[model samples]
Target: MTDPVLRLEALRHGYPTPQGRLPVLDGVDLSLSGGETMALTGESGAGKSTLLHLAAGLDTAESGVIEVCGADMAGRDDAGRAALRRAHIGVVFQQFNLVPSLRVGDNIAFQARLAGREDPGWTAELADRLGLSPLLSRWPEELSGGQQQRAAVGRALAARPALLLADEPTGNLDEASADAVMELMLELTRTAGCALLMATHSAALAARLGRRAQLRGGRLCDETGAAA
Candidate 1:
């Protein structure tokens, strides 16, 4: 049997402040299934990004366990974590994080190359899906914000990772562009059977994900679940 795409147990984290320790996540627990898409929404400073960072193993939690695809993140060293990320995890940040020096096609294929899962055909198909086929030779700086973001999504999906963690991926785009990008991302993830967990501030976007959870006062509430 396959394990969950992601799992967190009793997660607690905080940061040292000028006055004292500022708590972020407090004994939080969450999970996402394979091929599932979940939207995480919260107010600024509510620790949504913090939760993603911990889930991605980019930051250490004060305590708790994070399991991605059945492996325990808390047990991995830096190299182990890096290897895990390269193997099964893909991250799309708000900034698009494309390689400015690489051409658009190369940028989209970069992570797949690093993950050693390069599939030229799939990458080309993704480019077509994202409407980036015409701009594949262009540089990141030359593309519009929506195009850059589409390239970022392509890069993350090229690896065909088991899980995709997106941190406000459409936050930089206009409303129309945001809607298009979000739609494409969801479609691609579903086709590729990749689990998606996106952190966003848009309630409308969250509602489209089928499941929406909010981090409120260090607790994760199933907003849609509550409604249902």
Candidate 2:
């Protein structure tokens, strides 16, 4: 059988404060396979974002293991981690980190080009499905919050990465817009058979995913509050 798309085993991380090292993630463990979606829920400061960052290889863990598509992330440098991320992972941040200088179309195609997997057909389809075709030539500043977030989603999935990580992706949108974005994200990821791991505070949104995992006391638990 094939390996899981993302995995974390006995993960631990902490931050140094005036008092000492305060633990964020403590012995966290998770595994996600292809075409699966998992919602990560937690209260504020529960290490949800920290876990996602470590899973994406954007930050290092104090101890334990992180594997993406069966490749271990323990000894990789920044550049190496970046290479792996570009090749196998996609991320959508709450802030919608689009390139201000690039037009919407270019932004949508950015990650795919970086991964050397750009396909005009797929980009065009994404633009059409995301309702951004008309706004492709417009600058990001000209778009509203929802539009900008849609562009960010397109950009992240453009490369068809094996795993997708989203941190509060709909936090900035209104109720209607958030629902629309969520629907599109779920549809696209499902169609592409990518693994989705999203960090969210909304119970409604979390329920939409196939599985739910909550962060508490630096570890993950199931919807019933049992250890995951």
Candidate 3:
């Protein structure tokens, strides 16, 4: 089989606490091929977010390696890792992370501009597809929660990153809005040929993805098949 677009091998990470170095992930391994969508499901504080952070290069692994689009992140310095993330990773967080001052259109194009890859046509298309066309000129604070989330999704996908990491992208939306956003996210990620790794608490959401994995006791395992 071809190598995965994103891979984590023997990954371990933790944060310091008064007691000790509290391990968040322990020897976790995962792989995602191009156009594949994998749902990460687990209880609260099950290291789902930590795994996503490690995969996105937002945090470092204590031991092991994270490879994105064939580049080994383990050897890179912070700047190098940042460059990789900017160029090849798209992330959506539960908070939406939209800039209050920027208009919806500007927020959608921000990352692409940062990467020197702003595509006006792509941005327009994304805005239309995400149903943000009418709100393009409005500031983030003026939009509803679903609208803000949609803008965030558009922003992350506009850059056409090789890997897409989403942490509960639909967590705050109502059922109808959540389903709509999930459909749009899945469709757009497929169109972009990106690998998707989403951490969610919803079993129904996980069932929609190509595969499902559960995080528990600081490790990840396939929920439907044998352990990876």
lDDT of each: 0.88, 0.91, 0.89
Ranking by TM-score: 2, 3, 1
What root-mean-square deviation over C-alphas does model 2 reach?
1.2
State the weakest 10-residue window (summed lDDT) of model 1. Answer: 219-228
Ranking 1 against 3 by lDDT, winner: 3
**Tens-digit per-residue lDDT, 1-228, candidate 2:** 998999899999999999999999989999999989999999999998899898888998899999999998756988989999999999998888899999999999999999999999999988998789999999999999889998998898889889999999888878987888788778866888899999999999999999999999999999889999
Q: Name the lDDT value of residue 84 in candidate 3.
A: 92
Q: What is the lDDT, from 0 to 100, of the residue 212 in candidate 2?
A: 96
lDDT at 134, model 1: 98
Model 1, 145-211: lDDT tens per residue? 8889989988988999988999998887788777877887788668877888999988889888967
Clashing pairs in 2: none
Cα deviation of 190 in candidate 3 (Å)? 2.7
Model 3 agreement with the true structure over 77-172: per-residue lDDT tens digits: 899989999999999988889988899999999999999999999999989987889999999999998889989989998998889999999887
Best TM-score among the predictions, by candidate number = 2
Rank order (by lDDT, best first): 2, 3, 1
| Per-model TM-score versus the true fold | 0.93, 0.96, 0.94
Model 3: CA > 4 A from native: 224-226
